[model samples]
Target: MELYAKVLNYTMPVFLLLILVEQLAARRMGKQVNRSLDSVSSISSGMTNVIKDVLGLTISLLTYDWLVGHVAIFKINATWLTYAVTILVIDFKGYWVHRWEHRVNILWNRHVIHHSSEEFNLSCALRQTVSTVFDYFAFLLLPAAVLGVPVEVMAVVAPIHLFLQFWYHTRLIGKMGVLEKIIVTPSHHRVHHAINPIYMDRNFGQLLILWDKWFGTFQEELEEEPCVYGITRPARTWNPLKINFQHFWLLLRDAYHARSWKDKLRIWFMPTGWRPEDVKQRYPVYTIADLQAYAKYDPPGSSGFSIWAWTQLLVCYGLLIYLFAHLVTIGFSHAAVYGGFLVLSIYAFTELMDRNPHAWAFELVKATVGLGIIYWLGDWFGASQQYPWLTPLVGAYQVLSFFVSAYFSAAIRAGQPLPEAESVHQHGA
Candidate 1:
């Protein structure tokens, strides 16, 4: 876990830099591919996912060591050829796992966060799930295990495979001529993220396009049919914690209200978005029926709110970096507490950005808790112990953040648009 944190500390900055480059390139091309709050929410979701992973929150149902021991059919020697084969096997398994998440009702919860963003961009790719507490796809890698692919090889390949998918999540790139036919490209992934009827649930492959093609899930980006991103049912909130389990909560509610015993039992395993007839009729969750009429979930906010959200995101990010740097010294309990604080901070600030009616109250509670923690610890979990100057710096930042949050909360309550907000509203009009 410590090793993973160290690696992420290095790679995350690179990912952020690429995202900035994509934003700049899109602006140059006269396209606004990112919304301020949405992009921040996406990155915040990524932070939660990384924290969950570094904390080792997931439990694997089956051990790969056991699989390699029991089912080895060929003891392939480690070579370049063996490494190439291992990657192919991993991609194949990824395809099935990705397909399963999209096709099954229950498993969709684990992946819904990724698709929650209304915009499809590099930032959206960072929107991963924290609700996936179990690693149930270990059996999917049985082919690799049986081939005598060492667990160490998989450990080396897995991060690379996931990171490789990041570059393709942009709109600045068009379809590559021959590469589009072989590997997953920007165009291919754009189709995957689309909610269009023709494109929905298609192109589930991560690295290679072969598995999607072979499995009949591939759909090409059509010139006639432009891709509309996001899920059919919109995740209306910017809070990643809420978005993470929104689908599962709905599923649970449906199961509880379901009349038939069979319906309750099968609802989870059934196709995505399938609900019991009785529950569907009674509860009636809103789903998009007309693609043309659907609007993106953008709440009205001033530039002030955007600045506030961005500032909070940066502070939360700094906290995460601090936690990662001191994961060993702080120990699990402190890390967990710090992680929880970061999640709450993200949730509170995002709620404000979304212009929620009760957001001020939440922000108040969050600020109080944050100040209390800082006062209690006297140094942001011992950062001052090493860099004594960080104590006053963090202290001032927290005090300033509270005032900013309070001011925004009052402005939101009063329904008085700041000058920057009024300018934004007029510009949009």
Candidate 2:
């Protein structure tokens, strides 16, 4: 976990820098690929995912270490040949895991957060899920274990494999000539994220395009059929926590209310977006039937609200970075408390961005809990000991945040429209 945190500390800044570059490139080209609220929500979702990972919040039904110990037919030496084979095996496992997540009903809930955004950009790639509490794909790596691949090799390559996918999640890049046929590129990934009927569930490869081509799921990007990014059923809220579990909650309700015992038992394993007939008929859920007629999930937000959202995000991010840097010293118990606070802070601010009717009250509760924690601990995980002035500065910032939240609440109460609700383009592709 400490090693993962160190790696994230370096890679996160590069990801943010590239996102800024994408935004600038979009501006120069007169296209808007990043919306302020959407981008904030995306980054917040990423922070939650990282916190979950750093805190070791997952249950593995089967252990890879156990598999490696028991399943090896021959031990392979660590060399260039071994590294090449490891990459290929990992990518093969990745392809199956990716495919299963899209094909299964319960599993899709774990991946829906990644596809929730209407805009496909670098920030959107960071919108990972926080609700995946179980690691069910351990069996997928049995082939690697059988090949006598070392766990150390996997530890080194897993993060690199995940990080490499980030560079392809942009609209600024087009198809590469030969690479398009061999590897996953920006164009292939764009098709994967699109909700267009022809492109849905296509291109499930991670590092290589060979798996998708062999499995008959590959689809080429066509100029006439531009991709429309987002899920068929929109997640209409800016709160990442809510978006993470929204589908699971629906499944739970459907299972409970299903008429037949078979329907109740099978609802979970059914295809993605399937519901019991009784549940579907009695309690209807909204879905996009006409792609051209739907609007993206953009709520109204004034400049004051935008500034308030950005400030809160930065504050939360700073707290996250501090916690991550000191995770070894802070220990898991205190880190969990700090992680909970950060989650609440993100939830409160994003609700305000969404203009929720009860947002101010949530903010008040969040601020009060924050102050109580500071007073109880007497400092921010021992920052006062090093910096001397850090605690007081944080206290002042907390008070200021409450006032800023209240001010926006009052402004929203008045009969005024949000300052910047209009889109750069009147319609989407």
Candidate 3:
């Protein structure tokens, strides 16, 4: 866990640098591919995902080591060739798992957070899932097992596989010539993220484009039919945790409302977006019918509010880095507590950004608990032991965060709109 955390901490700065570069690239092209609150939400979602992964929240029912040990018919020696085959096999597994998530009803909940963003930008690439607590897809690595790829080699290659997918998420890079046919590029991924009829559920490959083409799920970026990013039903909020489990909650509601047992039992496994006939007519969820008419979720925020959001993101990010760096110092239990505190910090600030009237209440709870932790530990997780004055500073920051939240709460209650946001062009749903 410590090593994994360290690796992620090292890579995060590179990802942030790329995001800034993408912002400049977008400006040069006269395109605005990112909105402030949405970008914060996206980055915050990444923090949650990182914390969850570092904390080891998920269970893989089958282990790759066990699979290779039991199933390998041929042994490949550890060399550059073995690592090359390892990455290819990993992406091959990714293609099937990603395709399943898009096609299966219950499984879509595991992936919705990544697609909840309405814009296509480098920041949105960080909006990964925090709620995929159980996965049984290790068996999908059968090809690698057959080739006798060592488990140690895969452990090093898995993260590289995921990180390589990040650079292609930006709109700043256009279609690459020959590379587009070989690997997953910006054009291919944009289509994968699109909700347009022609683009829906296409391009399931991650590192390679071969899987999509071979499986007939490939959709080229059309000149006339522009790619419209996001799902058919917009997530409409800036909270990643809520968005993560949205599909499951909808399925539960539909199951409860269904009049027949058959519909109730089948709703969970039905194709993605399928609803019972009776429940569909009676309790229709909001889905964007015309992509051209739909407005993206861009709540008007004053400059001060935008700055506050950035501050919140930075503080959480700093705390996360500290947690990663000092996991041994703080011990495992306190690390979990620290992780929970960061989650609360994100939830409170983001709810406030959504202009929730009760956002102050969440802030209050978060602050109170934060103070309680500092008081109970008497050092804010060993910080005062080093700085001799940092614990009090943290306590004050907690109080200040609450006041800021309450201030925005009152402003929202007064119905005072912030300055108007710039106009947004709608893409396909």
Candidate 4:
């Protein structure tokens, strides 16, 4: 089997299990709990994105197509000693880069996108910078290629490193007694996600936690304190572009206000939202009293609509499975078909859930039925035999149905009413 097949094998079952667990967890939470089809779809999409990055790198490695500098920097001699050393060096480099992502403003601009979601689960791990691969290879792979690391060895090690980190992103695992001293554990990573002042800027390990312990950044997990995780400022929306660029935009604006070149550089490299001494920053720290006095944007709870939304999601997924199997049978490209189907399914399911919660379930079943009808038309009418072009048309129709379903889901999210704005009593006004 191809490497892609292996990755699929490793990833799909994890996602399916998480989906089931999340549904149960949501039910327990009640009050329109966070877990839904959108949640699972997000995780699946994230995995696909990660896989794309790996595929790109794998192709370059197999074809010996990386830059001369990259080849030299990431090169290894392909011996056991070299393999061991490569792992250590790459891990050490990852430690500092991971740490810098949390500390530096420009980097944090990219990193904050991952932390924007308040809900933490297996899917949250998949949320990442697509450009993360470029940045990672640029810095980390330089040494390996420079040293003449066999591309094959580096290739195997890199994905293994990544695959090892996958389960660490979940909420399921607790502490590992002695293992916690060596490699990163889920408990240690939860600390990294916490917004608590004490926990901030700690635990930057990817695979090995030893770097943190050696560098004095390690703090043992504290059950009593409990982790309250999320970014300091919430993203509050799901637009991927905005999630990626919001902090970047703010950084550029603040850099413009610097009194000197040094301050400007500092503004970009320092933690996000930093200012020079001459500049005064406005802080919005809502105290307990203040929160009680004015609490807009706070809804009581979700109406009883998630069940209907979920029904639609399940139906869409069922059709996706059938369509994928059919596409494979017809010799249509699995890479293109599966990739497109997954993206469309996620967007459509999200749209339906957000649009009309009451009709969401019915619409999902209806769409699935419509797909069956189309498949029957192609088969019974002998469209493939008569027109031949009708086959592609049916595929096109599937794509269109995906988009329409997505629109409905988005509409549902927007339909919920927001709190009223407060009146202003400015002296001038």
Could you give candidate 3's per-residue lDDT for residues 179-273 as a string of tens digits? 99999999999998999998899999999999999999999998899878888878888988888888889999999999999999998888999
TM-score of 1: 0.94
lDDT of 1 by residue, 70-118 (tens): 9999887778887898899889889998999999999999999999999
Clashing pairs in 1: none
* Separate clash counts for every candidate: 0, 1, 0, 26
CA-lDDT, candidates in order: 0.87, 0.87, 0.88, 0.56
Winner by lDDT = 3
- Per-residue lDDT of model 2, residues 1-429, tens digit only: 989998898888899899999999999999888999999999999999998998889888887788999998878878787778878888998898888889888999999999999999999999999988999878878888998988888888889999999999999998899999999999999999999999999999999999999999999999999999999889998899999999999999999999899999998898899999889999999988988889999877665567668778988888888888888888888889989989989988998888876677888888888888889888878788677787787777777777666656676778466444232112110
lDDT of 4 at 372: 64
RMSD for each of the candidates: 3.2, 4.2, 4.6, 9.8
Model 1 scores worst on lDDT over the 10 consecutive residues at: 420-429
- lDDT tens readout by residue for model 4, 1-429: 145444555565676676467557656766232454335435534544543453343222223236333446443457897788668767877788788888878778657756655555666666665434345333455566567767577666765676666566655567988999889998888888876667878899988999999998998779877666566655544433345577776667666765678987788777654666654343232222321233222222233334333443454444343343343343334344344444445444443433444334543554464466456554412445555775565555455444444444444567644211121111110
Quote the positional error of residue 316 for candidate 3 in Å.
0.5
Better of 2 and 4 by lDDT: 2
lDDT of 1 at 23: 92
**Winner of 2 and 3 under lDDT:** 3
lDDT of 4 at 130: 42
CA shift of 403, model 4, Å: 9.5
